[model samples]
Target: MCPPNCLHAVCEKATRRGLLKSGFTLGIAAMAGAGSLAGGARPASAATDTGPLSFSKITDMSHTLYEGFPTFSGERWFEMERPVTWEKDRVNLNRWTLMEHTGTHIDAPLHFSEDGNSVDLIPVADLLCPLAIIDIRAKAAADADAYLTPDDIAAWEAQHGEIPEGACVAMNSGWAAHLKTEKYTGLDAEGKNHTPGFHHEAARFLIEERSVRGIAVDTLSLDRGLASGEFPVHYDWLGSGRWGVECIASMDEIAPSGAYVFVGAPKVAGGSGGPSRIVALH
Candidate 1:
């Protein structure tokens, strides 16, 4: 069963209590592990005002990195000493290497789009969008080789509602939970990853039928980890001017099925995909 504290389908691992000063950066709050909403938070009630005037802020879905966390291959690590210190009335800050996709992040067209938009090329407005999350955790748990099909999505719509056009259609397959354990990622005996992904039909349905802005997932890649040589899914999705969002976390808590989704990715000068922070507001 899902945990009660979970909002947006994410499970809260821990929580802290404190009064936050105004103008604290999210990075700072995240580093301090204070006052932020726990993971898997529910959306505000319909009667409640969710606008700026209403809630101060909900849970931040992004994950942080230091030690004792899931590192993407060799992309993330810490040095012997701290990188920043407010030492005796003076602060010394240092620069360290950060991979394009570390912690909680989104991928750009350049991630898979050969001749498509780079991290900097995508419009800021385009970063924020309406969302549609289709949960397939149960099916995925039953079969690691499971895939998202139009039929499955159609079944969801039979209950939830239709997938809107130009919206960010996110699939919360509950894969992030598997990040800590080998069983979560469902990696095979041969080191091959076995995870849930969208079928070509589902991708086509979103790209053509739903006219989606893009597709996002809580996994490493949008395509099924064990593709049998053919990558029609990638070729079709990116080739059709649509993009993909990967390595995302904390999507399950979102309710209303359709809400505005946003991304704050670094616009590296002449960069490729780079890293991004994703947000969702109903």
Candidate 2:
């Protein structure tokens, strides 16, 4: 069920066909008036006096978790046990066992920083923010070890203007297409995974220059898989008191800019990280 006065409520009530046909525009002021509703501020492209902003589409950017889903450790991280069945117990119930960082998940600052915010300690406002997607699909396709570099950030800004303040910058390497295949993990004979991620410099640039709320990626880890044990990007980004999302699905569906992302991170006390239901509206 949608929360009272929440943006999900508006999405739930409006049919996609109806929204398209009527060219419905959601009022930013209305959303802001809802107190704790998502998208506390409007995008820079949208003027304060513009009255309303129209979002033509909504996309779910999270991947489903199952027993066999890929994990950084090359071991299964999710399992389900049916404890009760309707035919036998008159009700269906199941027990789930999973790791905190399984599937589409958020990496709270505490994941790396000793004195950082835990999953439950993260502020509500930071969970919802503007989305900036950096496309390195071509590069990643040719070189699995490719990472989002500072040049990529500059190129994206050259085309789409500067990344908005407090935005969630995501790297779209088109890696989600490899899910369910060994290619997704890209493990070699040495057991090192070859995947796309963010370069430390790019992560630092976003934090020091753009003041972004977080970073996200379509790959398993924030640093290039070849980085081995040195997680430079993770230490620099999360240790700096910022959050991140990993294994994000459908990043290709969202625009490079002008989209808002809602990261529904689990509020597990003292948790380093947890699975999240991430959605985008544009």
Candidate 3:
């Protein structure tokens, strides 16, 4: 007989393997496409006449998942058990029990809209796009309930050129610095989560005015924590058939612009969303 929750264990392994395979395939396809456009077959290591597409640095933007990672409900949402021990079974295997939205995760449109796309249904092309980091660290340092407003976006564009269409606009609130701490959630005396996120107007601007593929944040939700259970950003953005990433890490390493992001969202069939491995290249 199989152990309890064995299906979840299998699914976890499959998800990891699938992500790796997909990345590998995509990389090869991109290289081949570049070579084809160059008018001749070129070795994978050879640079194109216009110069090879390369990154000077790669930064991981996904936070490590652990049993104690904070969740929206203020409860422990991840657990792990070593079902196969190295000393006893000559191998190491763990069974993880986690909520789809735990840790650093993607929020599919279906998370808010019934007729929206699920994680697996999101277009592969949308997962890879330019990254635009909107720095709100100073504001958030003063007010934990600070959020990305349309004015902030305008200011960012004024300095760093207009945000590229189909880019992922991320909020660098410096919240990742408070990970695994009580300050991360900033629970008030009344049990309200005081974290930085996207303002409703900002969400509307990105969705209606800009052609962004999605939004990301270094916090727990797309809406400011003080929204008092009113997730306007979440509903507005996701309802428009776009996705969002939350709990991102290492925002400090990525520049405000001139970087591309790869969102390694899981391919879980019918899943509303799942923990994702997000990386940035610059």
Candidate 4:
């Protein structure tokens, strides 16, 4: 009942959407960085404009119902059934008991710092902005404790141009591929995790130099889980009162660099960083 060309377009759109939500990337990867965001971020007050972004093909960077995946509680759990619901006296309610850091949740400043901003306190304007994806998968495959150094970002800039201020600096480490298994965590027998994260210098650049609105990643924490020496990344970003997006599951789907509208938010009341969705425009 549809035009032939339109049908093909629909099929392609469906495929892209599946690939995005399924957390599969068909491109190179990058690493996370520090952030001095939130001071003077450009506000994307309007998101209704259309462009080459293929909103129909938008991807959900949050985790799905996968068991043994990391959560804030330092444990792994996910939904087992489709309709996680309970009904009583015809009062049917739709509900899902997800962890605060489940899916694509933001890390409010309060998440780490003793006196940091909460999800509700974040300005609605800061939540949306252009996105920057930095790939560091190659380094990660070699060293588990590999961090995204400023030199790496500099190299990326040499090709992609200087990372514009107010852009959401994200990383693609290819770790999403291993999320289903323990190795994806890159945890060693010593119970220490060895994964790619923000390099101290890279963190400083994103925060003090480029002034990105926020830092996002497809990993457990902005800093590698194995970090214990000084914690430079956390010390810098949190000290600056910038938020972090953690446990993100995808990045390869987005354009290398472009104007994207961020739509992720929290529960407002009892939320630290709830599962949220993000979309990019060409």
Error of 4 at 119 (Å): 0.6
Tens-digit lDDT track for model 3 on 68-176?
A: 8987567888999998998999887899898899899999989998788888888776777778999999999999989799999999999998877667899999999
Model 4 lDDT per residue over 1-282, tens place? 565489569857867678544533321111112122443433322222321233334556666645545642347544544343345344333445566666556877666676667777766656665677888889888877777788888887898887765567887888778776676566666666777789878888777777576788777778876435456777677656677787666577776676464656765763456666654543
**TM, every model:** 0.71, 0.86, 0.82, 0.72
227 Cα displacement, candidate 3 (Å):
6.1
Q: What lDDT score belongs to each candidate, Candidate 1 first?
A: 0.60, 0.81, 0.80, 0.64
- What tens-digit string does per-residue lDDT give for candidate 2 at 93-154? 79989889889999998998888888898776667677899999999999999989999999
- Candidate 1's residue-wise lDDT over 44-98, tens digit each? 1221222222122344556554443444342244332546777743675556566
Q: Highest TM-score: give the candidate number.
A: 2
| Candidate 1 TM-score, true structure as reference | 0.71
Ranking by lDDT: 2, 3, 4, 1
Counted clashes in each candidate structure:
15, 0, 0, 8
Lowest lDDT 10-residue stretch of candidate 4: 26-35
Candidate 2 backbone collisions, by pair:
none
Candidate 3's C-alpha runs over 4 A off are 1-53
Which regions of candidate 1 are displaced past 4 Å? 1-57, 66-89, 226-230
Which candidate wins on lDDT? Answer: 2
